[model samples]
Target chain A: MKRNKKMIIAFITPALVTFLVMFVYPVIRTVIMSFFKVESLTASTSEWQFAGLDNYIGIWKTPIFRTSMINMGVIWLVGGVIVLSVSLLLAVILTSGVRFKSFFRAAIYLPNVISAVALAIMWIQYVFSKKYGMLTSFFRALGLDNLAKISWLDSDMKFWAMLIAFCFGAVGYYMLIFLSGIEQIPQDLFEAATIDGANKMGQFAHITLPLLKGVFKTNLTFWSINTMMFFVWSKMFSPVETEASTISPVVYMYNIVFGTKGVTQRDAGRGAAIGVTMALFVLIIFFIFNRVLKDDDLEY
Target chain B: MKKKVISAVLCTTMAVAMLAGCGSNGGAKSNSTSKATSAASSAAESTSAKSKSTEPAKAEGGKNLVYWSMWNETEPQAEVIKDAIEEYQTESGNTVTVEWKGRDISTIIQAALDAGETIDLFDEDYQRVGQQYASKCMDLEDMAKAADYETHSVEALPTALRGWAGSLKGIAYQPYTSGIFYNKAMFKEAGIEKEPATWTEFLDACKKLKDAGYAPLVQDDAYVLYSYGFQIARHLGQDGVVDLCKNGGWAESEGALAAAKEIQSLVESGYYSEYAPDAYPNNENEIGYENAAMIVNASWVPSEITNNTKCDIEWGMFNYPTVDGGKDPATVANVGAQAFAIPDNSKNGQAAFDLIMKITTGAFDQKMALDTQSIPADPTNEEWPEMIAGCKDAFNALTNVYDWNMGLNTDADLKTVIQDNLMKLFEGKMTAEEFIAAVDAASK
Candidate 1:
């Protein structure tokens, strides 16, 4: 037994070392970097200055950072609700004795297969284009001349347009997860619910919904993760210059580190601070999900 | 147990080998040398004897000169320079290896230099040398003097360098500037005789175009700060705006408020196209498609107009118009350029310097101007595209040139505030006072 145990340990050692080198080391290093006044993200250690809480203080003082945080919050909360509700609905409809189940499922999941950049570009150029866009043409077809005249890609409406496009792509992915969860819930539960004189809606609420609590938690976690990484869409939608309406913390961090859009200075410490803040945000959401959504797994 | 030990050893060896294999290629030196030796020997057997007496450096053991061009082959300037490099190699019997890294050359150069890689030569904006890569760049004042670059160009090397890097650090590869490009047919239809010279005339032209049932001005949100900054430059001199940035006294400055008020009036007057907020290239597309009359764009717009669109409309350009009660002269244009810098780690610094000299001086500037359809930095070079000839007059009459507002402002937060509020002002979301106040608060 001792020789077998030693042999097992020997096999696991390489992977353990790799995990430490690849993930754990960088996380710790980033946390350390947040406290310093780093000139460049790629700068050597000696170039870093001990800035303490100054980087955090500086970010909080900037109104754009606050706007970015608020924009992210909206995308997280509002976008989360829309994506989850739509995806759940689609999942229920597809799984509920629907003909062409495979075709519908594949069609819904198609957007997920395309890259985020390509999807965002397609929406910006084809759908949101002011002159002859799909939205404009549709509005005109409906005889809504005023709506057709309104610039969808402009500052006031750009965020919503981007959010809608994002949700369109996001729903397909989450719906697949929900569909799988629905499939696992046995037909026995539905039969039992029907015998108890419950309607289809009642069975969905009492039997289908409760059993999919675990999947909900999983979907919610993934949604939060996606919201935190919200960058490419914001980057693609916004102009060359950063706008308050569309700025995300991740996008702000990118511009800060890169010194883009006329930002002459690069501060890696502040970027790391933003990173730490984002991680904390994800952690808080994770903990809240774990605490509030607790349920025992229903056995067959 | 013996079998297990052998398997473990084999696994570790394979992993280490995989990691070790991801190292440098060193292709620049070897590939360039081999190509040069074969190519040079074939072309220059007879001429090498005569050229060896005049230029000993030309009769060299295959010297590998590496250059990273900031533009890809798609850009006319890059093509012209690449041809020149090929000509230089064949004539001088020296080896040159060039990498067309495009706009992402900064990140590539930074990574290569940080890794202590041989970064012999690279082209980037002049400001980058002083702002970020000063430590890695070699001063080119002696080289510029040797090449007599100042006498040929309209602006001296120090003058051009100061606009970007604040000091002489690199040599100008080519001159590129920004101004307003208008549709001549549209102007003629609006009954506007010529390009506007002052604020009043500009406003009048805009109104005339609107009355003539046309979108007077078309601009993207991306360039809002730049368009507004030119107005600010007119009100406050370049130094005053710089002072505003340093002192955070934007709220106190009448010039800043005046600049905002002007843009607010334009927005209120409905001079901008409905598609003004569209992303870049799209706004230019509007102008190209005759959906709008004019656009404030960079020198590259002329080339982009032909390439990106198929419209057969005649194009004309004018400098940013003068303002009423302005501090600076109307001829003051916003000028910038693409330049080359030699890295301190360069193995062939002299060769790299000579390459730049060869490209920018003599008939090269004229050839570049004609090929690229851009104005020559050398005011002496009379060659220009007929469409851009009027702009050359404005360029020649320039009393001063300031960097674009977006590029000039050093404070990132204030820059963001300026761009956001200006965009809001154009969208009628914020007033002039609110825009200035927001910028002031952010600056503080």
Candidate 2:
């Protein structure tokens, strides 16, 4: 037993060291940094002023930060619903013994392969442009002149327009995950359900969904993670400093740390505080998901 | 067999552990180096800048210098600089590699310097000397004094360009003066011979242009600030601007109201293009295409027009029209572009300084002025861009030249506030008083 214990310890040592160095150290440093007043990222620790949670309090007081949180919540909750629902629907259709599934999957996945900057430009210039845009022309062709005249890229509608574009690019990724989960269920269970006078809807409800609990949890976690780190789309859409409508916590943190939004000052401590808060939020969401969406490991 | 497998795993784990430890050590070393490098650079900058020691000129040898330029290859300014580099290489026999960083120069330079990378020279926004990379930049005051730079520069060196700790830092790579760029042909067609000298006459010209079926004044959302900046300059002056930035004093100020009211009137008069809300250079393009009569833009606007539109535009520049009964009626709002800054860690500081001096004072400056159709720093150089040639009287007699921000050394956020409120004012969403009140609230 002693020799076995020694072998187990030895086997785990490398990964343990990697984790402590890469993950544990940085996280601890960031948490510590959150308490200080950091004027510059490149400044020495001696230059750092100990503010005792002042940085956290300061971010809380900032109206823009609050606005960012509300924006992020909308993206996470509203975008989450649309993405999951549409992806599930697409997955069900694709896996229902549909023909030409391969072609359809590849076509849907095309947007994911493009860079965020290019995709944003295409949406803004080609789709949402005030003149000669796809949406405008389509609306006009359908004789919906009022709808066609609406400026999609205007300040009032920009947030929803960008969100729709982001969802268009994101739906395909989650759909693939759902399709894989559906395919993993035992064929015999569905056959038996059909044999017992169960219709397609009943089979899906009894067998398919229950089995996809693990996949749903995974998809939810990923969606939350993506929502938390929502910077690129916001950045591409705004191009300059983010607007109130599109600002996210990650984008806000980036602006604070880099002073890239023409704010004229860097506050590394405030940025670290934002990071810690975001991490905490994500952790809370993950735990809630795990608790609410319980699943057992089942074999085919 | 189990013993052998366990032993093999143990060996592999130990090796991996050792490798991880080594990697961590390497990372720590790099971080320490970055810190040390930045601190050393700051120290060097202070010493060189304060003492103003005449560092001896070195022999033009095989040493190569690296230059990171903000201007892309396509810009006329970039073309002029490239030609100068080649000329310098042949004449002085010194080697230099130029990296065209364009709009990404800010982030790229910041990251590179943070990583302890060597950057001998770079062109960055003049405000950066005061705001962003102050410590990393070498103070060129002593060099400027030794070179008698002020006399040769286009405008008298303003103290606002000082570094954060109050030292003359970078020299202007190029300077841009903003005003009305109007189509001379369009003006003739409208039966207006002379450019407007006052706000009232300016409006009259706009009316005439409108009567002639031309969009009188075109603007875009991107640079709407320029439209009101000239009027703001006349009201605030340099000192008033500084005071407004430091204290909450903008609400209902005569200058602020006049400027705001002026823009609101122009916007309400239907002088602006229909596509003014479109992205920049689109509405500005109307003047080049002869769809619009005039635009309030920098000296570089014509270059943009040429590049983006196909029309053979007969462009002429005028000083931003004076406001009748304003504090400084003849104020010219001049904006300086990125300047050449040497890194404190540069291995060849003298060489970098020499190259910059050569570019700014020598024939290269003249070439740049001719090619870009903009003013050069050296006013006595006699080589004037054709468009600016028409406005020589205004350029010479200009008593005040302020940045579009009115030279208010405030937070960039305050500038954004001004811009946003100004946009709101133009859009008819807010009154001039409300706009000023908003700025006042933001300042507080």
Candidate 3:
């Protein structure tokens, strides 16, 4: 037992050290920093003193702060459901001995290989172009001359349509993750269900889904974290400057420090505060989700 | 015990990583300075004292020189700098490496100053760093005081050029000029006789184009909105946005609001679309050239816009139409390109300034203009490209130049107040009275 404990400590030490440095230290600094008024980052003689909860209040009072939460929520629910449903459907279809199963999986995972910036450029210039865009000319070739000038960006249904585009580009990769998870279930389970006179639908609901609960939970946590950070894309090309468009709270923090040409390049203290808040939000969501779902973890 | 030990380790790691950033940048600075000091005592001792050109001058005892500019020193303009870099290298056996950071020179300079980062030379487009001039970033007067200063600093460029550097706070690296452009083919098809000179003529021509099913003025709301203060100077009757900045006022005068109303008319006229001001960088405006008749763009606009769009449309620039009372009725100067000072902590000021002149006035100007259609900053380049060279007549007329948002000293507390609410003027969110009050409210 003593030897085993030593082995465990040795194995965990590297990861523990990395986590402390990468995650916990920032949170500690942020908690300490949340107590002060920010000044220019380079004030030599000036000091960052304690100010206790003021930064928190300042963030809470800002209208954009609340709106960011709503936007995150929207991305969460929408991305989660669509991702789950499509991924499960693909998983089911793939398990049925599809002719080009390997090829299909690779094709869907293509988006994962492309960089975000390249994907953004491809979508903006070729896919969603407004006046004289590539999509327009394509439509015109098909006899819809006026459609060549159609701008999806300026339409009243902007967010709705953009949501669909996001889903299409993103679903394939996550679906592959589900496909791998789905493939792991034993063949005997399905055979047993069929022998028991359970129809395909009944087997899918009773056996397939229950056994796949672990995979679903894993993907849920995985995607929730992914969607939470979707602001990375939102800041790059959304049309409006609403909290939904130009900034997420983290990106907003970036602008606060780096955007202006002033003496304050970045406020380390305030950045820490923002980081802590973000971590807290993510943790809260994780707990709330776990509590609501009871996170059924099953063993074979 | 596991949690405690884990927490301690986590805290230590976090402290180190964050400090790692502080360490790299800060350590670099200290390491350079100490090396520079050691070099200052003996030329032989200094060459190997530092590893990079982080110290102010004398990296390997002048084996290297660094020039930092707000943007890339690219072709059509970088040639002179490249030649000068060669000359500089041959003369001293020192290679001048140019750091071409695009945009955000102001913040870079400030950070350098704070860190005492040695910069050799720094310059940026005036509009981007104009706000820096409103505060003290660096002083040209002091540069003139430097022992290595040249005869070029003695006489200075032309007054307008000098003004480019002279908010009395920061110095301009070079002077820039502006002009107007129109589609020559569009005018001929519309059969509107000539380019408009007066406001009525301008409006009339616009109406005719509108009637002809063309957007009269293709103002890009996606880019920073371009409105010339000089042409409207005749109407404002005051010193324009400048005088207002000095005395803490915004002109509610008949002229200023009239300009706003004119723009509002264009917006309300269903002839306009804008990317959200902050968000337009990637939006539909990149595809702007195919739809609109005329654009209020500087010389660089043609290449930048047409780079992606291969439209073979004939375009031309003319003087911005003016009211009878405006200063220099043909003037269109509000924002134009100019270089700005580097932070005082520059390590290689000589090499940087040497590069600036080469890029701006030297042979690079000719090469850049010919290749890229970028207008020359020298104001005397007669060997011109046909389309761009022809712009001199229009370029010379710019005066009464002012943009509240363009200068370095923009009152920041009021910037959002002005920009957010002022955009509403284009959105027709306020009356002219409200517009003036809204913008002015920021300064106060």
Candidate 4:
């Protein structure tokens, strides 16, 4: 017993130390920084002025920051619904003894394997381009001039265009998760359901969904975290500058912290406050998911 | 018992491996620090030796100078710099170690400086070097005066540098002016004999171009603020524009509404292309393809368009047309430059300044301008690149230069608001009044 405990301690120590240094310490520092007036990220702690809630209040009052928050919220709620539904549907279809299941799975999961930056560039340059774009060409070919004329990268449509592209890339990863969760359920339950005269839809509704509550909660939590940290797609869509239509909280934080071409004021404190706000958003979602989807009593 | 022994061996190996990884990093860091220390000491010794000797005493092995550059290794400018470095080494008996840090150098330079990195000299945008990293820079006033830098370099550039940095902190290497970069072929095709000098003439030119079945003007979304800001700056000087952006009284500003209305007329008259303010490099590319006649952009646009589209274009430039009753004259234009600065922590400031002078003046300046299709920093090197040759007159006529975006981007919070509404105004989605009202409301 003594030897086993000693071995465990020895094995865990490195990881524990790494986690404390890399993750926990940064988290604590960021939270503390949110309350201070830190102009530069490299500024010494001695130079920090205690601003209390001023940064938080200032960030909220900034119109661009508020726009970013709304944009994030929309991406989270709307993108979550589309991504979850599509991914779950694909997961179900793939697992229903479908033909070419492996090939289909690989095809769908390909995007997740690609770099988000490259994927976003592909979307922006090829798909959303007004001139010589795939969508424009396709719509024009179909004699849909009105649709063809729509500038997909315009301010009004850019956000939705980015969301659709991001969601398209995200579906594959979540589908794989759903696939694993679905595959874990015993075959006997489904056989029993079929034997009890439950149709395919009925079986899915009563057995599959109820059993997958835990997976749904997991996916929701992951989605919440991903959405909170959303940056790359927004950045790619607005490559030269941050647009009001595509700005997210993280991008806003980046602009204020690191400074962009147009916006040169670096406010590390406000950036920290934005970071804290995003963390709280993710935490609140986690809490809500835990309370709403109780998976403890659900048997495998 | 055997499994336990294997597990113990594996764990011990893993621990050793991790320790070795960390130890290697520490060793490398220490090695680099010692090297830097030696380099500094050598430079100091050389400086002392030079002071004592009538003839310059070259170190047995040349003293090292580290330079962090904003250009990529593959860029033509970097190629010119590399060639200049070789020439400098042979001429002055000094070794320059250059790290091509690329465009993100601006974002990371401060951190590197703060960390006490052994950076002797670095180059970035003149405005950025002046505004953001002024304290990190060595005051170059004495060196500049001794070298007669103001006489050698573009007159306005050093003056502009002083305006930003409050003293001579850096010297411009590659100066550029922002104006209307247009397709000269399109101008000839439209029978526009002369480049527009005022707002009415500009509108007449636009009409002729439109009548010739061409889009008169095109702007990329990236440069919408710059284009609009120039118009506003023509009305109210760059300072007034900055004040308006910082403290939002756009509707009440003397010529803010007038500028908006002028831009609105352009929009209404179909001066802008169908996709006027398309995403960056898109609308600019249109000019190369002959889909558009002109774009209000920096002198770099022609090179960018050519590089991206591989299209041959007869490019010409003129200053942004003067607005009627504007505060600033046509002479007041937007000028910017890339500059070299010696770090405050540099042990070899004189050597770095010498290297900067070598790269920026005489033959090297002309070489850089020719190779990179950029303006020559040295006024003595009068051979302008073919594409931007027309910019020389406008550049020379400049009495004052404005900051990037005419200082409208001074306020971080309001930049997005101004940019968004400006885009809307250009797209004809919002009227001039609505645009002013929207910006003013956002300010409050």
lDDT of 4 by residue, B230-319 (tens): 999999998899888777787787688999999999999999988777877678888888888988988888999998899898888898
Pairwise DockQ winner, candidates 1 and 2: 1
> Compared with the true structure, what per-residue lDDT tens digits does model 3 show for residues A144-231?
8677655554423334445555666777777886777767878888898889898988988987787776667667777777766665
For residues B1-444, write the lDDT of model 1, one tens digit per residue: 797888688767856764566454433322334446666675455443322111223434356677777887677887788767776676556777777777777656665766656766778776665567666677766656655667766674358575455555676646766678888999999999989988899999999999998899887877888888788888887788878877788889898899899988998899988767566768777777786787877777766776778777677878888788888777776776666788877877766766666676556767888887777756667878765665777677777777657233667766777777787888888999998898888788
- Candidate 4's C-alpha runs over 4 A off are A1-14, B1-62, B90-93
DockQ versus reference, model 1: 0.50
Q: Name the candidate, 2 or 3, with the larger lDDT value.
A: 2
Tens digits of per-residue lDDT, candidate 3, B61-112, equal 3445455555545543444445545544443334555666655454565556
Best by DockQ: 4
TM-score of each: 0.90, 0.82, 0.72, 0.92
Error of 4 at B238 (Å): 0.8
How far in Å is the alpha carbon of A41 misplaced in model 1?
Answer: 1.8
lDDT of 4 at B8: 83
Winner by lDDT: 4
Q: Highest TM-score, which number?
A: 4
Error of 2 at B298 (Å): 2.6
TM-score of chain B of each: 0.87, 0.79, 0.68, 0.88
What RMSD, rounded to one decimal, does every model reach? Answer: 3.7, 6.7, 8.0, 3.9
